[model samples]
Target: MFLVALIFIIISYGMVDSLRADYAEKWQLDFQDPATPVMEGIINLHHDLWFFLILIAVFVLWILLRTLWFFDRSRGTVPSKVVHGTVLEIVWTIAPSFILLAIAIPSFALLYSMEESTDPAITLKAIGHQWYWSYEYSDYTTDSESLAFDSYMLPESELKEGQLRLLEVDNRIFLPTHTHLRVLITSSDVLHSWAVPSLGVKVDACPGRLNQASIFLKREGIFYGQCSEICGVNHGFMPIVIEAVPLKEYVSWVSSQIQI
Candidate 1:
């Protein structure tokens, strides 16, 4: 009976792990699995900061509890008349500065990496509308036409089996794995942010001004995101989907689009 129960538990855990694919789950507290190096860095930094946070929280709680227990009136203990110690003041101040320094070093390194430019194999231009997203593959053009398409969220009524509601889009941006990609973003109407948690990408879309970000997908998967900024009434309807495929598959897709 014990062996059977252990096998059942293992199977159940595998089922739950398989269901979590590049999208947010219900009541999820942890981040989705990272698909890019940038996201992996972000998660690592988060874990490092959490270690410090937990240590600080526990130390503060211990101080509070110890004070309450020793200085309580019920304990008949006398409070010390001494107010402040210079050593304690300096220790607290200097210790926090060191902690801030430690946190800032890695943060600045990650920020610099995110802004670093690379010789991209593909350039994708994303334009934000009031309630939708449009993508253009500017690098691959057919003399007079470029590969461009508008992506809109699929309504619940039209959703197919196993499709995630509100996260599914009619058109998804196709990218190639292990290739450096440059994404240029701007807005036609209002402010919108293109954000994908698993990819560690979130850039603001401002009218008349262009913003760029670099992406290098480490794996092939379907990642989902929504408009992070509030633009208008239908802001929630704008969803972003990216389908990463192998290099050969991506070439085929580009050829197909050009032929069309």
Candidate 2:
């Protein structure tokens, strides 16, 4: 039983990298490939943290088994009455503070990178409905007539052979790779959240309020995610499908939607 458990854990760990690679292949923005220095740095730091946690867990488990039997109270172990050790308390607090700082600095840099903007060539406004998504371009003033569309979840029977359920949409949002886009997201009814893990974005869609975020797709591929917040019965049906295409293809797709 122990051997079987160990084998399963090892196999699962080995597949983790492949799972990440699959996401990369399916959703890496055309210009924002995994090879970018910014994303690569973040992924590497995440890997390091995972390594640290796994090593600590294994060491602690080993110590528990190797010492528990020898230190059990029934086996004559005595309790110590040292409840409040100021030095120990201070040490634990300060160590965690340093550790958090180590994680925070890199995280803040990535955040700033996402927020940086010189001049965005395009803008998209996303409206979250009870169970659908509406997108408007050119400040959503109708005069721009840039492009507007509603995206509904594709029904199970309507899904393409390779399309996964709960992630398929009727009209997937299209955007150009290597371009910075400002997305203004708001809710039509209740609160919802628009999140895409690959893009490292998660922002709330508030009712009657406009919230914006910038996305710079460096790669070209399809990325998928669903409404992250529980709004209602159909919340699970709200999926966001973004296809980052080459500049030419994206522009053409936008033009095609304008005719709709």
lDDT values of the candidates? 0.91, 0.74
lDDT of 1 by residue, 1-260 (tens): 99999777767645432244489888999998999899999999999999999999999999999999999999899998989899999999999999999999999999999899999999999999989999999998788778999999999999865678898899889999999999999999999999989999999999999999999999988899989999999999998999888999999999998988
Worst 10 residues of 2 by lDDT: 16-25
TM-score, each model? 0.92, 0.73
Task: Give per-model CA RMSD.
Answer: 3.7, 8.7
Q: In model 1, which residue pairs have backbone atoms overlapping below 3 Å?
A: none
After superposition, the stretches of candidate 1 with alpha carbons farther than 4 Å from their true spots are: 1-20
What's the TM for model 1? 0.92
Largest TM-score belongs to which candidate? 1
Per-residue C-alpha lDDT of model 2 across residues 1-260, encoded as one tens digit per residue: 99999778657645432222213235644323342334555576677677767866897799899688877878997757789999999987997788778778877887787666547788988899998988877643345555677999989989644566677788878788888778888999999999776666678999989887877777766777678889999999999988777999976876666665
